[model samples]
Target: MPQANIDPAIKSVHVFSTGAGEQHKEHRYGSPLPRLLWALTSQSWIKIPVNAFVIEHRDGLVLFDTGLDPAIKSDPNYINSAIGRFLLRRIFRLHIGPDERLHKKLEAMGFAAADIRKAVISHLHFDHVGGIADIPQADLLVSKDEWAQLSAPHPEREWILREHIEIPGAKWRPVEFAPTDDPLFAPFGGSYDVMGDASMILLPTPGHTPGSMSMLVRTGDTPPLLLVGDLTYQADLLMKDQVPGTGDAKLLRSSFAKVRTLKKQFPDLVILASHDPETADILAASHSSRP
Candidate 1:
């Protein structure tokens, strides 16, 4: 029962939360933004939480985004947080070095490194890919556009690709989500049945990072859960109609529109935040099952 996302046989299933953690560093770097941003987001100041959601499917495991890795796991600098003089380097995640890991948790649930079918990265960012090594056998499923945007000769953020994007081992499967299911996009879009009735629908909710994507999880006749990656850092922000840390103004607005629509369609659906402690609590309580 714990191994499947749904009733297993009822509809093929597999989705994992991997683990949960927190981040308290948004105020220092957030204040410089235009007043309009603060006015729109109502978050001119405050440290925020960074969370990671890992999903498992019948054929593979889809990681919504990678959170802090081993580097930050044992870093003394990150252990202690102060109000002033916050260290950015201490906050930024690094490529997982060794030892500190999430594999043990997965193994405890009877899963092996090779058990992961695919690690779908919502976008190319360190926090989301920190646990890449945890699923060595799985191919890296990422959006070609996202990769292109990050790996472009002149990328917007250099740190996004630095080693994490171009890693050793594992197969990299780049996919393009389609608006109408072209050969390239159909396989990547709509609701994807993992193992059971549980599905991860890749909604093209760009704007957060050009190629940013969000997922919809349906299970147990329960309220659907939408994993909106990085679109908004805080769940309350979405619930309160605020803005996120970073996103193309227009694109963010478009995605925000989707957010409102989804909320209306599935009022009971849990709209999760990747970097919100409250969301992590919800995930731990609601989605604690290994499957």
Candidate 2:
């Protein structure tokens, strides 16, 4: 799409890290050893940011994903299941401060949690939806397929905690993607236009999770931004067709191919991943550069 044809509803895009976490090198760069082997025995670790994005649209503020909750560090009973808690300790190490909470992060950025009109969740991972409770008034848009996982037996095993997501007074809306005739988005088969203005379109990426999705932000003159949550830890990894240690390998490759195709269509497209350590700098450069 031409820059002139892009939507101008988006005024600016910003990102904030709720906190940082340490993951095994295998978990991030991939490993030959099985997940359990690495999770249980690997001593190598890499610190990564738990990031969330803010899109300043003319109509209202929008969040790509809510970052990690501080409660996970403060509350011993954050994860309900004993096994889940044990596995979490072995799998990752989190570093979050009270001020890093979603509301506080937004407030520091000159935005209020109440001012948020919509939060397009990329997936149901605890870190992704951690801030939902802070923004109860906003419509939480999650992929229908992702939301269905909650009904599956022992969802917590997959790290989808019901207590936090199904919390009282939270507005969770399952999104059903509709078929789009637009050539640019036809490969995705369907899309959900968040504002019904083509400013932000949600595409089913699915790989990191069964129903994971990505948001395409067309901000007129600037390069288009794709908020790909956990699709790949790094854009370079996705470009190289490298799969991470977790998630379904087959699905990850398929989604990676689709995103690559979109990148081909728009050479200047900026792919942002939730935990990619370099995303903040890349986003800043993308905003500073002209299309």
Candidate 3:
């Protein structure tokens, strides 16, 4: 979309880190065999931040994704499956304080869990949906494909725990992306305009997971922002067509190419991955020109 076509309702955007975790370096980059070998033998770790974004729009506060749940570290049964529990320990090391709970984290960020109107879940990964329990009143939005995983024989096998997701009183909505005539989004094929005004849109990027999605945010003053949840660990990797150790490699490449096309069309477009270690510096630099 052209810079002139931006909306004015969006006042500002803020990025927050709910918690931090460490994964094998190979897991953040390279092929599955290397990742497995590194996981099995190498102690080299890469710190990744579990991020959630808040958009201050005219309508209300909208959250791109909810960060990790602190309970995963303290509660023994967090993963449920015996194998999952063992695997989780080997795959990632998480560090979250008692104050890192979503509610408290939001409070620290000058917002409240109760104030969130809707939360767009990029995918149903356990870490991404962990904060849903804290914001029960907010409308939890997920792609139809992502939500469909819940009905599968065992969502936990894919690391999406149904038990944690199907919490009582939580309002979950599965949304279908509609075909769009808009040229800017034509490359994406389909999109869900979150605010009706096109200030925030949900685009199906897939790859990281079959139902994985990304959010596009545009405002009059700031350059366009794409909140891609694990589409790539880093924006540079997407630009270089490098697929991570996990997910469908073929699908990931397709999504990466499309995102690069969008970036080419809008060079100033900021691609923020949920776990990108440099997200804070990138976001701060993007807004440095303003007061």
Error of 2 at 192 (Å): 0.7
Cα lDDT tens digits, model 2, 218-287, are 9988889999999999999999999999999999999999999989899999999999999999999998
lDDT of 2 at 154: 87
Task: Give me candidate 2's TM-score against the actual structure.
Answer: 0.98
Better model by TM-score: candidate 2 vs candidate 3: 2
- Model 2 misplaced regions, further than 4 Å: none
* Residue 97 accuracy (lDDT) in model 2: 88
Please, what are the lDDT tens digits per residue for candidate 3 over residues 155-177? 89788999889999999999999
Model 1 stretches with alpha carbons more than 4 Å out: 1-49, 56-61, 72-87, 90-99, 108-110, 154-158, 181-198, 284-291
lDDT, candidate 1, 1-291, per-residue tens:
212344432222233343444332342223356633443444223344555555555445555664556655465443233421133333332334444455754565565655666666777765677677667777776666677776576442333634555667757777765454423124334433333343555666676677777777765544567787777776666665566445565777667676676666556667786666567566655554422
Q: Is candidate 1 or candidate 3 better by TM-score?
A: 3
RMSD of 1: 7.2
Candidates 2 and 3 compared: the better one by lDDT is 2
Those runs of model 3 whose alpha carbons end farther than 4 Å from true positions after fitting are 32-38, 289-291
Minimum summed lDDT over a 10-residue window in model 2 is located at 1-10
Provide the clash count, candidate 2: 0
Score every model by TM-score. Answer: 0.69, 0.98, 0.96
Which pairs clash in model 3?
none
